[model samples]
Target: MSEVLVVRGEMQPWTDHTARQPVLAALLADVIPANRRTLILGPHSPLLIESVLAHSADVTILVRSVSDAEQLTETFGPCLHVVAGALDGLKRAAAVQPTLFEVATDGVQPFEVVVAADGLDRVLGYDSEHLSWTERLAAVRSLATPDAVVVLGLRNEFSMLNLLDRRPAHLRHGDDEWVPLHDDPTRPVSVDQFQAALPWPAQLYADFSAHTLVGVEAAATARPGHLPTRLAVAALESVDTPLLTSTTEPLESAARAGLLPAVPTSWLAVCNAPTPHTLYTHSGPTTLKATATETGWETTVGVVTPDLLGTVGYDSTVVPARVPGGESVETVLFRLAAAEDVPGFRKLAAALGEWAEDSRVLLRWDDVIVAGDTFAFGISGWVAPESVDKDDLLAAAWLRFHRRLVDGHRRHPWPPWMIGDELVSTWLSMSGVTLVDPTPATAPHVESAYAEQLAWGKQLAAALSVVLDSPEQTHPDLRTQLADADRARLELTELQGHVFGLERTLGFRNKAMKTRENRIRELRGQLQKATTANNKIHSSRCYALARRLAQFRNPRKVAAKARRILRQNLNKLRPAS
Candidate 1:
């Protein structure tokens, strides 16, 4: 059996067991049409193949090792077009040297779709001399049709994950030069930068750690408004993302519209040339419908109208009102506004501006405007613009996203204990961030420390037991004190059980009292109704007589009827005599 190729201390032939695969596949299924010829670089995942096959597309998998190719051929049979060779060699033959492709079994034909499922990382590590990001991307493009869709799975560097995981080290294989890999381009390019990098226009979908590709112009201004609620909540709760609140803008218009700021670790990029299509994006052609006011600009998004800048609850009761966008970008500058952290807001805005366009930073008084309270300060909302997959890819992506949330929560537990921090507590409420795990850190040292403490505790308890039991080590008074303590502990345990029983009995009695009280109230109501009827009867003389008659009529008629019957019987008896 051929051993799997290892890179950077990880197996290259297989994909990580992540939820991203299904999500990416689902996204791909949505974008790529069935019956299209697809070129898959790096069969890093069986899920990638399954996603491609789901659409019944013409599939081709290119692997670097001969053993991998042979194994794939056996596993998938003749249906799979498995090719073995280095990407650099293929690039040299097809592009650099103008030679025929070794894997061109049925002759080279332009592929309608090309997927870098293994991502640039694996592709970069395929040979001794890794390919540059631009060259690798260009080489992948060469296998595509004129207007074929190009999908790239990218990692986001700005994610909260990077802050915790600092494990990147690049070194030359032969030379001892310790430098970052050529493939290690500053990741997570903006939508504009990403488009500029590509020969064709493209859109980006990013989370905290990952992104996906889609065609340009596919990103609608309103796309962020319609994400899944769970997905939206994840984004909103993300402390790493500044404009996660932008998702709530669409919620005002429609409840079913999806939520945002997914913080997913993987990204998907779609390049459209042959067929232009729409894809979801965070930032798109957002038109700021704002009207200039005496103090500042009044903004409107979705159904929320006349959003007065630097004001709290000015339009609290107001419905949709008219507002117009000025030619200039809206920037609500604040100076000495009550309770407004102008400096902090500016700092945060500067940080966020790195990822967004037309970066207008504003400070508004946050917190509810109480009847008497005069001051409030915080961030209310922020907007961001930006820009998935086949079915198996989508399923994998969904699974990955879910796992990320679950595992992420497991990693960095929510701060329920940090309720004292108003900002953090409030952010938790507004954002969809929830408690995944309550345990502390999950790192090796953290776990090891816990284990050590537990062992120490057990040892301490055993030592205490031994010391207490050993007559040689213990004083007579100490032994007597220990016996007394044991007796007290037993007494306390018995008292606790007795108290528990009493508490249950008290609860039952309380319920019975409540039941009696309700019954008494019902009877009182009935008595009140009867008294009212009696008063009504007494108020009218005729009604009183009719009511009395109703009460006595039946007895009086029965007595009168019995006397008449007796008289008739006496008359008949006399005649018979």
Candidate 2:
């Protein structure tokens, strides 16, 4: 028997984003390499598949598993008996139409238009069991030639969460004795199953840009001709999926060995090809572990990768509902307090209950949080900082926050919330600050708080900074201090001038008094001698007069020396008044 064509299902868009991000389309444009034959298995978004098929015709497209007999019986009836249930479907289909599955579009697909739907499903990943599904898929693809690009298309059901198996909304066991796996009880209808119904002339396409990989040209005729003109299988890897050519050294492609997504026999046909168990063991969800280390505590949640399930690790966990004190867990947060409220800054702690909400409009970011006097929050999300150019949207968000805060503060007088700046919030914070450490205990709380704080803090900090740094008060304290210093200096200058003048005047007066006595004594001797007593008797009298003058004139040399000393000393003092 030729290889049986077993596919999961297909998706078609009634709306837009679905086609824009069609699984196969992305794989074709991205992960799937050029010129390779691949069998895309899974129920598909019909519109999405068609869009992928747009103007491209090289690869093969597998529609459904041979085992889905029920879906077939309900839709097509006994005509497709061999391919009824998911199991039988794969077995019989592969027998007849195996080789003609689909063709690769030479990696070239041209499209007229591509548009996004308003409401997009959350990117795939989910349920603890999904880990096995991912692993199986990877293992199956490994069987294909390493040089050949293998594309695995996931439905929205295989959500981002599916990568780990967070309990699917609904989980069940599909009968596959050969495989020990279960269906997601929560959502049996996966993204792949969600197909774009092409009624009559209506059709849906998946190319987001101007190009297309696979397009479905369908019309209600005698039978469904899934034989795509060019069966193109686009590959999908996580956005970060490494290129196969990235140096063929130990290119350890990771797979969630645990997720047991139901695969068609076509996939099982190649499962053994990758040497399934030789390289890395297929993984399954192991239970979370709670262990103690020297560093206080540690706990892991739901699923941990690269480790065998049930492997022990250290971390903390917020007890779920039935646990006491857990009910109050409104949120996890990194609290940024005002300078004054440094210690036990609990406003954010308190705000957790407020921010933890079920709406997407809310800021849902938290991943890591460094806790201390204040907290730092972070998340694991990609942001195209350069691509963001919506100033108005930023402004609008800010306005909404402020308006909300105002209403909240009025409604309930609690933590006085404040709004932050718009520009920062819009451009800078859209690419956020990552939390240093994240814990499951803080997941709900942190996620909400991170979102709220970034949105709030960016706006608040920007606005406050601008206002405080305004020309009016940027240098208030320095300007005031400078003005005071200038005034004090001027007063000191006036006082110095007055003090110098008084000192000079007092010194001059003392010198004048001291010299007066010397002058009188010198003149006295001259006056008493008069004319040496006009004659002979006077000449005798002149001697007595000369005797009196002799006391003051005894040391003319000393007197001259004293006068010189006085002048020099006075000159050393400040100028005389």
Candidate 3:
């Protein structure tokens, strides 16, 4: 068995530029093997594969979403597989590469929550006390296609250690994974189930010394683990989580799948009654009807004809759904028939064959049909049992269609029938199926009342989420409102732009005016001082000329006046000019 290596870390955040490149780069670096069929699963892996096509390795990469990858392949095109419908996308991806390396991307179709296989036994070592999961890995390898490997990628975006060190207000239980239900009755099966979800469970869970695992079977006598079923779970639940895992707690990590409550056995039993559904088979289709008056409501299941599927098409409220691409299915309308009235239902189904040409119709009468007219019919609806064989009905139709050819087979013999393939396949699928050894506890020993209470609690929680995040559900009206909100936001942004522009213009104008005003004031003050000095010098020159004229007549008087005039002129010229 090829060793499964789990490489996990906090990749870069989902940003506007590249939400998940580091994660992809890390995966491509570690997971890819030469000449091996590797399935890499992520929302953005197609984008990464687009990058990977440049590396000319002889590797065939089967992509999930073909439309998304088709554009990418123009640049880098390895072998590509893209499903038309998003729901069937992953299944097609699996067909291309049987083994998968999954990066858990939220909000993508065929949204795989877990890549872990269902069954594996934990091997216990005497010295180390670690359960060796090599057997489990081997089983997975056997189930995997030839030359393929399964790898599950995990990302812890929020560091639990960070929470522990800082002791953030949001952190719960101080970074430790706590358990509420310690003495769980079904502890035997816990490790196995938990390990199945994990790529390397035994090694990963070996840490955490706080977990003291006291075997549930030893502790509880009445539990089914001690009985013949031997089915149990080493259940773990945080004491704080059960007490305070409120509706408001953040999921914290992208890969944190919220706790999925166990399917209590009693609820399964109560839901499963051995009531066989009445079925009508024809050439093309098998129809089933089961109508029982339960809690005063008429319960029904299965289709009346080729046209009417139970809930998918019967209600006008449901969106019309179909597989993408030109798939062959004839269009026909069906009138609801009351299945409780068995004779009326049989009559309705019989008449349907006559209603169509060449009596070319097959109908599956799965439920009881009561009263119905030609145009309109009433239905008695019942909850479908889990064991209802849908493939059996399809097989019956195929068999009927095969038998039609048998009449003309003397002219043309099918080698499959003549060579004996029909016998082998049918016996394996539908020859009064029976298990070799079954236990009474496997029949479901859970109490119905307790099971109902848990289911009610779950439903209540679901209802609360719907009520809180009702706006987020992709309903038509909600989509319209969201679009309107986006438009309004754009308009507001434009208005803010205008306001910013106006503010900038005002600031520029104010600064320019202040500069101009300061320059004008300084210029005016310098001009005034220059004028005053010029005027004072002119006066001194005039006085000196007058004194010189007077001194022409009397020498002594003239000398005295001339000296005084010269001194005054010198003072005025030196100081003012």
Best by TM-score: 1
Model 1: residue 17 alpha-carbon error in angstroms: 6.7
**Tens digits of per-residue lDDT for model 1 on 1-577?**
3222222212235332323344355456666778887777754556667777777556776665555566767777756666565455544434432322333545454577887745555443334455566766766776666677787765444333332222332311222112233345643344445556777555555432222222222222223212222223333333232221222223322222311222334455667822222222221112112233332224333233433332111222221233221111111111111225545434433332222222111221111111121211111222111101111111221222222323222222234342222222222222222312335666754542223322322332233223212223122223335656897999999999999999999999999999999999999999999999988878998987776668775787868988999999988889553
lDDT of 3 by residue, 348-421 (tens): 43453333221111221211122223311112112111222433323332233233233212122224434222
> Candidate 3, 254: how far from true, in Å?
18
Candidate 2 lDDT by residue in tens digits, 1-577 = 2232333221221111222333233333323333343433333344444443443334333332333323323543322222212212332344455444221235322211121121111211121123344344332333334343333322333322233322333442222122333353322233123231111122222221112122211101101101111011111211222122211111111111211122110111111112111000001122222222232123333333332111121111221111111101111211122233423324443333233322211121222132343222221111111222233223333343344333222232224332333322332233232232323445543443335435533443244323212233222233234556786887789878878888898889879977997898988888778656555564586777776667675488868888999999989896757
Candidates in order, TM-scores: namely 0.37, 0.25, 0.20
Tell me the spans in candidate 3 whose CA falls farther than 4 Å from its real position.
1-20, 45-47, 50-67, 78-143, 154-196, 199-577
**Candidate with the greatest lDDT versus the true structure:** 1
Candidate 3 accuracy as lDDT = 0.29
Question: Which candidate would rank higher by lDDT, 2 or 3?
Answer: 2
RMSD (Å) of each candidate, 1 decimal: 25.3, 27.2, 34.6
